[model samples]
Target: MSWDDPRPMSPHLQVYKLPITAKLSILHRGTGGALFLGLILMIAVLVSAASGPESWASMHSFLSGFFGQLIIFGFTFALYYHACNGVRHLFWDIGKGLDLENARKSGIAVLIASVVLTLLTWLIAAIV
Candidate 1:
């Protein structure tokens, strides 16, 4: 590597590119992390439920509240998004959809589809 090489270093974050794929990729990682945390909470819930009526009652009261419901909804969205995108990644790992155009399109599609699925799950939980 020449010390005086005048090759222009690409300005990474300075580039004014805010593509859908970029946003989705970032969100996917974020939601995946959220889901990991939510999983621990879920295990606690299940254990509490199995413990006794007292424990179940405490969990039930919290889960019945507005804030609890909101957190639950958010957690559900994270789980769905992570699961859906993980499947997409599996496809990529198998040498499918590696092209730039297809990857970007797929990322956008996964983001939209995950929101729709999340909403559907919430609706079902609310109604039934």
Candidate 2:
């Protein structure tokens, strides 16, 4: 359809602000990608461990660094976010929490649960 045509155009992202559910859906995809990359990094770590003592030490050294630790934290957050969001999708598949308010509440709960679970795992790991 030509822009000059009198026909009404379908609403696009540029035409309207996305709602919370849309935002969360976007985030869910992003976290899934992050988790995939994180898995690749994990494989690298394992391979380095199997390579040699020096290789394993180098990998460990990088992991112990500030930047590496930051990446690890991000990976952790992504892991938790993806898992919690997956559970949310499970409920959706069951035809529950399909309402706007329920979806919004569940999205918030997913975010909260992801953060809480990530922090709890890290804290418990550190304590042990």
Candidate 3:
């Protein structure tokens, strides 16, 4: 009646390798949580704008600082990454891109699209 069985356990994490899609899946969840936290910051910015010009300016100054810009950049990247991955998930829902090779290509495409879109958005913002 021992709980332990004679079956051998699977290899530990050290011996296992994760595929690109698996890595992206982990990143997708992490970015989702980051976006949730970023929403709080966005709300604070909006509230400051509603308070007064001085409050809005103070918030703007903080957002324009190096640390704030870095955080915003991270949030931007996360937003884009989550969006692209979401489209991929939608494809999965529609019974598409289910093959192993197709899944890998789609995962890579999502990553590239997210980075490209994030850079394109920032570039346009800087230009305007």
Candidate 4:
């Protein structure tokens, strides 16, 4: 290859058909990342609280906004989905639900339960 040479990029979604298993596997990883980030944010809040009231107050004040509320809501959903799906993975590790049909069913169940739990949390949070 010369300095001025151009190369073709690898094929992406445009040339690939994403399978259900592959998509779900990738989504599991992405949601896991989101959950880890949410935990880090929680740790930051804890550190602020432990440092001093002024720090705590600043953190609390920032979270009182619409964008903060939106982030909180997204975090809650990510936490719920990751937790529910984690348990599902655990069940598979214990020699259960390894069948392809059952695996698909369990994945569907996790999605439904996560949405319900997240919605309930939001409803309660709003009421309070």
Q: Which residue pairs in candidate 3 collide? A: none
Error of 3 at 112 (Å): 0.2
TM-score of each: 0.78, 0.88, 0.88, 0.77
How close is each model in CA RMSD to the real structure?
3.3, 1.8, 2.4, 4.8
Q: What's the true lDDT of residue 61 in model 3? A: 97
Number of the predicted model whose lDDT against the real structure is largest: 3
**Candidate closer to the true structure by TM-score (higher is better), 1 or 3:** 3
Cα lDDT, all candidates: 0.86, 0.93, 0.95, 0.85
Candidate 4 runs further than 4 Å off? 1-12
Any idea how many clashes model 3 has? 0
Model 4 weakest 10-residue run by lDDT: 18-27
What's the distance in Å from true for residue 127, model 2? Answer: 1.9
Q: Across residues 5-65, which tens digit of lDDT does each residue of candidate 1 receive? A: 8997666777867776677788888998888888888998999899999999999999889
Candidate 3: residue 18 Cα off by (Å):
1.2
Worst 10 residues of 3 by lDDT: 1-10
**Residue 22 in candidate 2, Cα distance off native in Å:** 1.0
lDDT of 2 by residue, 20-67 (tens): 999999999999899889999999999999999999999999999999
Query: Model 1: clashing residue pairs?
Result: none
| lDDT (Cα, tens digit) per residue for candidate 3, span 1-128 | 45698877788779889889889999999999999989999999999999999999999999999999989999999999999999999999999999999999999999999999999989999999
Arranged by lDDT with the best first, the candidates are: 3, 2, 1, 4
Error of 3 at 75 (Å): 1.3
